[model samples]
Every structure is written in structure tokens, then in C-alpha cells.
Target: MDEEILVKKLKARDQKVFQDFVNEYKDKLFRLAMGFVHDSFLAEDIVQDVFVKLWQNIDSWELGNAKLSTWLYKVTVNHALNVVRSKKKTSNVVDISQFVRESDDGGIEIQIPDNEKNPHNKLENKELAGILRKAINTLPKKQRIAFVLRQYQNMSSKEIAEVMDLSVSNVDVIIHRAKKNLQKQILKLMK
Candidate 1:
């Protein structure tokens, strides 16, 4: 369905249209949340909450102000960040095993040839992925969000700027710095 039509139906409280919208974007929103929180359950919760908020505010959404997808991304990111903050406040112990498990399923895995079945190669690839995930998590909040939106979400700088409410140049700079920081952290981890 066209976005305008979808929005119109949503604004009219069409349950079927809202269900379709949720089905279409739920996975994308979940992955975006996972990129921040690194916990599947938490990410799922965040996505659900975002959708609920979206439904509640659908009537107020200004159609031409921003794309619906952009608005969704912005809300997901903000909600995920808040969850992360609250989690930090409630728990000081970092869960190493959770990070290791997340490295495999958080959509940040390094691609390896399926033809290469060597156990050693697989283990090394997993280690590299864990290192990369850790490095990404260490970045400043803005940089990490910008990098995830650009890299994992495949969003352009302009799109990221719209979602983040930043200048396009500023989004570019954040992604650039994020790459540099990730490289440095990965090298340090490999050593």
C-alpha cells in the first residue's frame, strides 16, 4: 500500500492496516533495537513499545514532515537507548556470555564462505564477530546509532540525519569516527 493511503487508514484506526504495518516493519525495528540493546527479549520489547506508541500517535503524524519509516527508526532508536540506560542503572555486572551469544544472532556476524567448513575457521570467524560487536557497543551513543543506521540498516547519510535530527555532515562525521574507533578497538582486541 502507498504510504499516504496507509497513513490514512492508520489514522482512521483501521486495525487491519495497523496489523499489516506492524508485520512489515517489526523485524527491521527489532534489528535496530538489537543493535543498541544486544538482548533479543529487550529488543522485542522495545519494538512492541514503539509500535504501540506509533499507533497512539498516528493521528498526530504530519504526513509530509518525514517519511513513516524515518519516524519509526527514530522512535526505535530513542526507546532502545532509554532501555539501555535503565539497564545500566539497574545492573553493573556485564554479562560476557550474553555478549558471546549475541555475537552470533544480532545481525552483525561476519560473512564467511559456506564452502569453508573448517572448525578452526568457523571459530575464528565467531571470535572476530564478537570483537566487532564489542567494539561497536563501546562507541559513544550518537556514533553507534549513526553507524548502525548507516551500516546495518543501509541508510544514507541524509536518511540518518533525518532519523537522528542531525545535519547530514554531522551524521557523516559520526559514522567516520565510529569506523575509526571500531578499527582501533578491534585491533586492540585481536592483540
Candidate 2:
């Protein structure tokens, strides 16, 4: 469905449109949230909240200059940052593992190739993904967001710049630095 049509339906309070919107964007929004919040549960909550807010403010959406997706990304980033900020303010030190259900099916699985098919390659790839994630975590907030949007979401520098409300050149610089930092981190780990 075209975005303009979706927005029109959404503004008209069409339930089918709402469901379609969720089905289309939820996973991507969740992934983006996960890149910021780390915890799967928290990420899910943030995505849910973004949708709720979208529905609440549907009538107010200008839909003049930016695309609906750009609005959604901006909202996701703001809410995710708010969660991080609130958590920081509280300074809670609870061990997240205690809250996590460790049942075999219950965690966020980084899906590599099935180990049974190629155990060695699967293991190596999983290790590399872990290294990459850790390197991403070490980046400053802006750089991490820029890198995630560009790499994981396959967004163009211009798209990322709009999402982050930064200049295109600045987004490019941040992504460049993020790659260099990740490389350095990976090299150090290789030692």
C-alpha cells in the first residue's frame, strides 16, 4: 500500500490500516529499538509505545515535508532515548539476567546458519556477530544510531541524516568513525 493512502486511512481511523501498518513496520521498528535499548522486552515496549503514540497523534501528522516512515523513525529514536535517559536517572543496578527467562525458546536468538548444517561456520559467524555488537555498544549514542540505521536498516546517508536530524555529511562522518572504531575493536579482540 502506498504511504499516502496508508496515512489517509490511518487519519480516518481505519482499523485495517492500523493492523497493516503494524504488520509491515513492527519488526523493523523492534530491531531499531533493540539496537538502542539492548533488552528485547524493552525494545518491544518502545515499539508498542511508538505505535500507540502514532495512533494518538494521527490527526496531527502534517505529512507535508517528511514521509510517514521518517516520522516513525524520529518518534522511535526519541522514545528510545527517553527510556535510556530515565534508566540513567534512576541508576538502577539490577542484574538483567535475573529478569531474563533462560528457557531455551525465550531469549533473543542471533540466528546464524543452523549449526547442524555447518557447525564451524555457524560458530565463527556467531562469534563475529557478537564482536560486532559489542563494538557497536562501545560507540557514542549518535554514532551507534547512525551506524545501525545505515548498516542494519540499509538506510542511505540522507535517510539516516533525516532520522537523526543531522546533516548528511555529519551522518557520513559518524558512520565512517563507527566503522573505524568497530575495526579497531575487532583487531584488539583478535590479539
Candidate 3:
């Protein structure tokens, strides 16, 4: 269905349309939430909550102001950030290595080349992935969000700027810094 028609149905409280909408966006939203919280259960809950909120507030959504997805992304990011902040209050230190071992990759899968399928190479790839995950988790909040939206979500900088409420140039800078920081962190971890 077209976005305009979907929005109309949603605003009219069409349950079927809402269900379809949830089905379509649930995984994307979950992955986005996971990128921030790094917990599958929490990410699931966050996605559910976001959908519920959207259902309740559908009429308040200004259709012409922004795309529905941009609104959804903004809400998910804010809610996930809130959860992270509250989690931080209860624990002063987070063990990045522990999370790397236990956490999901926010729906991202590491792909090994066919020619590099040796067991030893596979092990090295997994280790490198873990290092990368840890480095990403350590990034500053804005940088991490920007990087995830750009890299994992494959959103354009303009889309990210809308979701993050930043200028396109600002989003670009954040992503750039995130890459630089991740490189430094990865090198440090390798040592």
C-alpha cells in the first residue's frame, strides 16, 4: 500500500492496516532498538511500545511534515536512549567485552567469503566481529546512532538527519567521527 493510503487507514483506526504496518516495520525497528540497547528482549519490547504509541497517536502525525519511517526512527532512537540511560543509572560500569560475547548484532550478520572458509580464518573473523561490536558500543551516543543508521540501516544522510533532527552535514560529521573512533578502538583492542 502507498504511504499516504496507509496513513489514512491508520488514522481511521483500521486494525488490518495497523497489523500490516507492524508486520512490515517490526524487524527494522527491532534491529534499530537492538543497536542501542544490545538486548533482544528489550529491543522487542521497545518496538512493541513504539507501535503502540504510534497507534494511539496516529491522528497527531502530520503527514506532509515528514515520512512515517522518519518519525518511527526518531521515536525508536529516543526510547532506546531512554532505556540505556536508565540502565546506566543502575550500573556504573558496563563490561564491553562481556556484551560482545553475549549480545546479538542488532540483526547484522557477518559474512565470510567462500574462499576464506577455513576454520582458523572463521575464528579470526568472529574475533574481529566481536572487536568491531565492542568498538561500536563504546562510541558516543550521537556518533553511534548516526553510524548505525548510516551503516546498518543503509539510510541516506538526509534521512538520518531527519530521524536524528540534525543537519545533513552534522550527521556526516558524526558518522565520520564514529568511523575514526571505531578504527582507533579496534586497533587498541587488537593489541
Cα RMSD of all models vs. native, in order, equals 7.6, 9.1, 8.2
Q: Give candidate 2's error at residue 38 in angstroms.
A: 2.2
Worst-scoring 10-residue span by lDDT in model 2: 89-98
- Give the per-residue lDDT of model 1 (tens digit) for 1-191: 98999999999999998998999999999888877776678889999999999999988998787899988998898898788667642122222332232355565443444536655655554454456566777799899999888776888998889888999999989999999998887666654
Q: Once model 1 is optimally superposed onto the true structure by TM-score, how far is the C-alpha of residue 183 displaced, in angstroms?
A: 2.2
TM-score for all models, in order of appearance: 0.73, 0.69, 0.71
The lDDT for every candidate, in the order shown, is 0.79, 0.75, 0.79
C-alpha positional error of residue 68 in candidate 3 after TM-score superposition, expressed in Å: 1.1
Clashing pairs in 2: none
For candidate 2, lDDT tens digit of each residue in 88-179?
32111222232234458776433444556764664455455445555566678888889878765789998998888899999889999988
Candidate 3 lDDT over 110-183, as tens digits, reads 34435455646554444555555566777998998998887768899988898888999999999999999988
TM-score: model 1 vs. ground truth: 0.73
Worst 10 residues of 1 by lDDT: 89-98
